[model samples]
Target: MTQTVDLNADMGEGFGPWPMGEDAALLETITSANIACGAHAGDWDVMAGTMALATERGVGIGAHPGFPDLQGFGRRRMQMPHDSLRNLVAYQVGAARGMAASVGGTVRHVKLHGALANMASEDAAMAQACYEGALSVDPDVIIMVLAATAQQEAAQALGCRWAAEIFADRAYNDDATLVDRRLPGAVIHDPEEAGARMVEMVQAGAIITASGARIPTPIDTICLHGDTAEAVGIARATRAALEAAGIALGVFPGRR
Candidate 1:
């Protein structure tokens, strides 16, 4: 039997009075919800409301932290000292955990968002900063990343559980990283096309990048970015396809 993979989505992007994605609707489809902390695109009310909704749906809760760049939505990288970055990540994770606990649940994992995650994947110094930040907040919270890069290895070495994540709604590079969004055909919005790509990856343990190259990546969790216009539809199709192909979807609990 093929091993099952979890379906996760980044959600809870609302900030202050500005509402973003349909988080409640998306939560119904995803097994894990990476709720945004106040850093990238969430505030107190947003976090609390999202937590309550996710808990009600029985979706696993995760802290989605990013650089403090609300304007760019944390997609634009910001250079900061290692200490500052660590402190910021820790603060965000702590806030999310507190909010989740208030809803009679707790954060199960931590996943960095946007530029912060991309930069930390290969940067040893930055990766350590984020990993330590997570461990400092909750030693047991699994850290999810796009691949098994140095960040993933470092987190494991520190006894922190980590999940190697892959995207079902986007193209990838030969290196197993996501294809640049600026490139043509980077985002897979079509449900059939996206489901086919994901089924191939989960069954064959490889993903064919937009450049037509096969990249082998052991993916434990698949990401479906909720901010996409077709997020809900794509998620539904992807889940149905995976189940049809005999890939059960659930959160990949790490060492903890």
Candidate 2:
């Protein structure tokens, strides 16, 4: 039997003339793209252009919705009511779906971004609210969740199509939460090191925490952050490493 997994990255994060990431170069390596939907870092032009690129690359398209915080880049967590959270997700997914359609593609999945994702990974109810918002717009849309966390729990409870994801360039704590970026060694920077770590985690069929503890879970996809200085390098290296290990890379079929 062969092992297969999806490689995804957040893109379309640049707003206006201030570009971010080597999107064109990175698209050559990833299997799926989580595009920002005019919230944290993208505007209409960015979304449309990105969707077109992802469509051309034959990469699976996903809506990467974050909190409405351009200044903080949605990394700073904000408190909001459950209804507000739900609306935020729905509106973003709807926008992404429309943009994808304009580019002759469609949003096949939804992945929460930044603080929204971090919060959801810790609170099942919060995750549920966000997923519910997405379902309201398109019940069939796949929800991508952080594996072995409250995000997973919420997805399970909702009985929606979902994929469990792990981070390739981020370190994980024993509880499976991502390490704070402010913390030492929280974000992995070396391409080769990031690639090697991904291979180990995929082979182990679990998230290997910073302390070297393994927490078993289904890994449907591995994510590489696109906003890093080494983003493209890490993406290519991770893909090469995975293929070298005889592990196939493909778009994930969300668990139904």
Candidate 3:
């Protein structure tokens, strides 16, 4: 049997007065938290609160750096220069890092969010730029990335620590990439379905797509989207089911 995997959740997307998810409950179920910086849908106050909650719950802290597209939730792709991209990434990461530090915590990792992450997955140049940006911020921070993608390869090549991420609430294509969001059956909304998917990935090291094709992957960490419908329920169920399958969640053991 393979070693147990960690389970992570994207959180802290709330921006002043607008809240999202049951942060406390999600923290209890997840071993790691990818707290959104102000770029997407978080502010300084929200970041501080999220970091504090996660720290108290003993969850590992990760900076979730996204494009500065709060209106579109950082999902809309935009043309950005390498230097601009680098600064944006660094800015968001530092924002989260500062908040975590204030709460007697430290940022353990960095994960690019939304369109930025998807672009980095397929674009070698983008991956290189993002990795360099993350290194500039904190050279030792583990970079969470989609397994087997260009981003993951580039991070490894640069001697940057990384975690191979798999999604519990999303379906994958034949090539192990997430299915298009607009497509039917792209997202696993049912809590039971989401939980089963996580268990299958952990135990079998494979993810089944909507077309019934199995894609092999190393699920070092499983991600549950904190903004999905019934996200709290899904996260709790997925974590519980994974544990029942003998998979215990924790930080991925990577270089400091």
Error of 2 at 21 (Å): 0.7
Residue 50 lDDT, candidate 3, scale 0-100: 93
The 10-residue segment of model 3 with minimum total lDDT is 247-256
TM-scores of the candidates in the order shown: 0.95, 0.99, 0.95
Ranking by lDDT: 2, 3, 1
Model 1 residue 84 distance off true place after TM-score fit, in angstroms: 1.4
Clashes of 2: 0
Model 3 has an lDDT value of: 0.85
lDDT of 2 by residue, 151-251 (tens): 99999999999999999889999999999999999999999999999999899999999999999999999999999999999999999999999999999
The candidate maximizing TM-score is 2
Q: Across residues 34-137, which tens digit of lDDT does each residue of candidate 1 receive?
A: 99998888998988999998889889999999999999999998898989888999999999989999988789999999989888876767888887887798
lDDT of 1: 0.84
Please give, for residues 1-256, the per-residue lDDT of candidate 3 as tens digits: 5467788889999888999877888888888999999997889999998999999988999999989899999999988999888888988888888889999999999999999988888886888788788789898899998876777777878878888898888888776678878898888889988898788777777767778887776678989888876888898888788888877777887642
Off by over 4 Å in 1: none
